[model samples]
Target chain A: MIEVNDIHKSFGDSKILKGITTVFDKGKTNLIIGQSGSGKTVFLKTLLGLYTPEQGSIVYDGRNYSDLSSDEKSDLRAEMGMVFQGSALFDSMTIAENVMFPLRMFTKQSKSEMQDRVDLVLKRVNLGDAHKKLPSEASGGMQKRVAIARAIVNKPKYLFCDEPNSGLDPRTATVIDNLIQEITQEYDITTIINTHDMNSVMEIGEKIVFLKDGLKEWEGSNKNIFKTDNEAVTGFVYSSDLFKRVQKMYLEEDL
Target chain B: MSYLHSIGQYFLMIKAMFHKPTKWSVMRHLIFKDIDDLIINSIGIVSFIAFFVGGVVTIQTALNMTNPLIPKTLVGFATRQSVILEFAPTFISIIMAGKVGSFITSSIGTMRVTEQIDALEVMGINAINYLVFPKFVALMLYPFIISIAMFLGILGGMAACVFGGFASLDDYIAGIQLDFIPFHMLYAFVKTFVFAFLLATIPSYHGFFMTGGALEVGKASTTSFVWTSVAIILLNYILTQMMLS
Candidate 1:
């Protein structure tokens, strides 16, 4: 579990994250959802230690991130994995090599052992045939899968993904979302995803935090989200006509 | 003020490159790859230009020595001096600032734009050590390239003198051997080593710190080449003044 307490971050005089306090539970799909310019990315980056909060502490599995020594922090980072929004696979390497990268960096495993792990993770991501292909040879959805394979190959305790569904089509987005949720449950890793996709919010958002203008507006499960009367939450979630109709149907069914 | 900031940042990057070095296995692969890219790939062009420019220097020197009192051997002597002192080292490096320097910037800048560097950082890798250190190591072989250029250049000068009938081969050989300060070669190699470091690091600094997308990568390449060339020229002047004057 990761617990954030009164985290505040600023760039120059402009504050981006304003005293956000929350808990992201283990073995669940924790989603940080906000519109563009709402600090979702900054908050995610803060959790990843990419940005230092001006105030408060983030406790990862009972250890305060800011309190660790540099070496300790680096060791802690080794237990973390990140899937970038752009699916930042090394263009120069084949998908197999990309998946094997973390093992090469941090593990003492022999080449054959590393190859076995790479093959296993590629199959886990349903990408067995793509091992020899470069990232440019794959489609957007396939690239994301490759990124996911690379992330999980290290067996990280914490997994972070930034906009995993941004460039994907609706069908591919759902596939990617389900894959992340299934991986979280299987590995029991503390997973946090940053996104604005409402489909993702209603689908795998087992634990969701809503942000508006850099402040935490609400936090709850998808089941409770439809019933909540919070104006900010409803206004943002049901902003689309389709979602508004879905919310209406939900209220009627509840009644 | 921005220039001061960039200079500070460049030194900081160099410092970061030495701290928390990458694993030896990974570093070895990176170094070999860079040697292929930066050194081995550059031999053809450097040799081609060095030879032809040396020929031109010989022809120009022979033509200008019209005074009956001047020795014909001066053609070979002047060609040797020009090639070793300026053509092979300084001019070839300026050309590389365009060729290899732009490549380093664009490749790294693309990584920056696509967030590959961020991925490395997220995995606890020292991005600077991973990205720039190998290039630094590969450029350690840069003097080897200059040495080749020196040989080809002097050979080209000899060919130009003998084939053009401006001087006999023996007279040219005599001129090349006369008043030969071995220290001049030392001075040239020293300049080559300094220029090598500049070539590797300056372009890296630009790429690593750049923002924006594909268009910005191109701009960074151009900017990197300009700054690297300027640094090389300025350093060349300083070293010449200090050592030769």
Candidate 2:
């Protein structure tokens, strides 16, 4: 489980992530969702220790993340895997080399064993045939899959994906969402994804927290999100065209 | 305080440079590439320079000879001194600044802006150390080697004088050859060392701290080359004044 408590951050008096607190449960896809500049990315980055919070603590599996030494922080990071906003695969390496990177750097596994693991992870992501291809050789969807394959190749206890579906088509987006959800459930890993994609929330939100202007506006499951009458939640949720239609259907159901 | 942080970061980068697996390979590749660039690419130029410089010095010195008041051989001495004091240390650095210096800046800057460095950090690797140390050692060593090569190339230039019959072999030897000045060699070594350090540090520093995208990387590369080349030329003058005294 991951716990964020009263996290406060500021960049020169312009505060972002003000006293925000939430819990992301294990064995589920817990999402932090908000519009652009709403602090969802900031919160995710803070949780990943990218931005050091001015106040509060991040506790992951009972360890105080803020207080660890450099080595300790690195140790914590080893337990973590991140998929960047743009699927930041090393351009110099082929897909197999990229996937096998963490294993090569952080472990003592033999080359063939590493290859087997790389192959298995690629297959798991439905990218079994792409081991020899470069990231540029693949489509954006395939690149995201390669990023996913690289992330899980390490079998990290915590998985973090930032804007995984931003540029993908809806069909591709759903496929990526399902992949994240399935992996979260199968590995029982505590997965935190930062995104604005409501489809992702409705599809895999075992737990979801909504942020607005750096504050926690609401927290609930996918089932309750559409039904909640909360003003801020409805305001943000209803603004989405799909959610608007969902709200229309919901209001008409009373007739 | 920012400078202190920058210093801290510099050391941190050097540390990362040492610890990375790619550091050795990249250093090896850059060195091999530098050698090829210096020797192969400049072969025609070096030959032209050696031939003309040797011919010109002997002819000029022989004509200026007034009843052998100064040995005609003194021309070779002047050329050798010119090679060591200014030519090797300054001109060769200009060539390298354009070549390897720009290359380092651009490559590392691209890595920085692209978040590859951040990825390394995220993975418990020291990004700066992984990038800086091998280059540092290489820069520290390679400049001296290049300077020596440049000095030898100049000597090859002087050889043309004797071969072309512009000056006698004995005149050439007597004029240029002298008991090695431990002090002059010391100054030459110092100049090479300082030049190497500046070449590595400035470019690496600029590249490592880049922001924005590919455009910023190109800017950094251009800036690094400009600044480091200017520094080499400026330092050449300062060393000459200080040591020649």
Candidate 3:
């Protein structure tokens, strides 16, 4: 579990995040959803310890982020995993090597031991046959899977993904979303995802935090999100025709 | 003020490279890959340039020796002096600033644009040390490349002098041995070593700190080449004034 208390962030004169406070429960898919220019990404990065808040403290489990020394921060970072929007797989390495990277860097595993772990994780992501192929050889959906495999290879306690569904087809996006949700449950990891895709929010959003202009506008589950009367939430969530119709059907059924 | 900020940032980057070192296991692979990229791959172009430019220097010196008072052996001496002092060290390095420097920048800048560096950092790896330090260590073999250039350059000069009918082989060889100051070779190697450091770090700085996407990677490579060349030239002059003057 991660606890964020009154966090503030800014760049130059433009204040991006202002006094956001929330708790991200472990073993659940926590989604930060907002429009572009909202502070969803900033808030997520701050929680990941990539950005420091000016005003409040972020405590991971029991340890406050700012109180940790640099080495301690690195130690904390090693227990965390990230999946970048671009996949960010090392282009030069084969799929197997990419997954084996974190293990090699942080662990003293032997060559065969690392290779076995890499094989297991790739199999988990359904990428067992792509061990020798480079990232460019893989399709967009395959790259996303590769990114997920690399992220979870080290068995991290916290998993953060930025726009994991972006650029993927709807079917593949759903697959990716379900995979993340499954992983979150399987490992009981604290999974935080930043996304604007409504499909993802509806599909895997166990806990959703809505942000508008850097402040938390609402927080709820996918079920409550459709019924949320908050204008900011409804305006962003039901903006699409398909979703609007879904919400209308949902309200008419009193769900 | 921006320049001052960049200078400070550059120094900070160099200092940060030594801290939080990456595991030598991963680092060894990176260093070997960089050696293949930065050093071994450069031999072809450096050799070609050194050979041709050495021949050109001999030809030019022979043409200028129209007066009988100027001995044909001086053609060899002049080729030795020009190639060793300037062509092999400074000129080849300037060329590498375009070839190797641009490669470093574009490669690292592409990683930046693609968020690969961020991935490394998020994994608790030192991105600078992981990315730049291997290039630094690989380029320590840069003086070896320069030594090859020096040999080929002088050899080309000898071949051109004998074949072009400007001088005999014995006289040219004798002229190469004439007034051969070993300190000049040391001076050239020192300059090459400094240029190698500049080559590695400046391009890395531009790449690592570059903002924007694909278009900006190309722009950063160009900027890296320009700054690296300017630094090499300026340092060359300073070193020459200090050592030779």
For all candidates in order, the CA lDDT equals 0.95, 0.78, 0.94
lDDT of 3: 0.94
C-alpha lDDT (0 to 100) for residue A23 of candidate 2: 89
In candidate 2 chain B, where is summed lDDT lowest over 10 consecutive residues? Answer: B18-27
Task: Kindly list the per-residue Cα lDDT of model 3 for residues A1-255, writing each as its tens digit.
Answer: 999899999998989999899999999999999999999888888887878888999999999999999999999999998999999999999999999999999999999999999999999989989999999999999999999999999999999999998999999999999999999999999999999999999899999999999999999999999988899998998788999999889999994
**What would the TM-score be for candidate 3 when compared with the true structure?**
0.99
Highest lDDT, which number?
1
Which lDDT value does model 3 have at A232?
92
For each candidate in turn, the TM-score is 0.98, 0.84, 0.99
Candidate 2 regions with alpha-carbon error over 4 angstroms: A250-255, B1-71, B144-148, B159-176, B230-245
**TM-score leader:** 3
Candidate 1's displacement at residue A68, Å, is 0.6
**Best of the two (1, 2) by TM-score:** 1
Worst 10 residues of 1 chain A by lDDT: A221-230
| Model 1 complex DockQ against the native | 0.87
Tell me the tens digit of each residue's lDDT in model 2 across B1-245. 97688679666665555563443433475455544543346545544554455455455655666675676667677666666666666666776677678877887887788667766667776666666655666566655455555556556646666665656777667766765466876787788888777777778888988788988888989988987888898998888798887
lDDT of 2 at A40: 85
Ranking by lDDT: 1, 3, 2
Q: Rank candidates, TM-score, best first.
A: 3, 1, 2
- Listed per candidate, the RMSD to the true structure in angstroms reads 1.1, 4.1, 0.9
lDDT of 1 by residue, A24-57 (tens): 9999999999889999999999999989899999
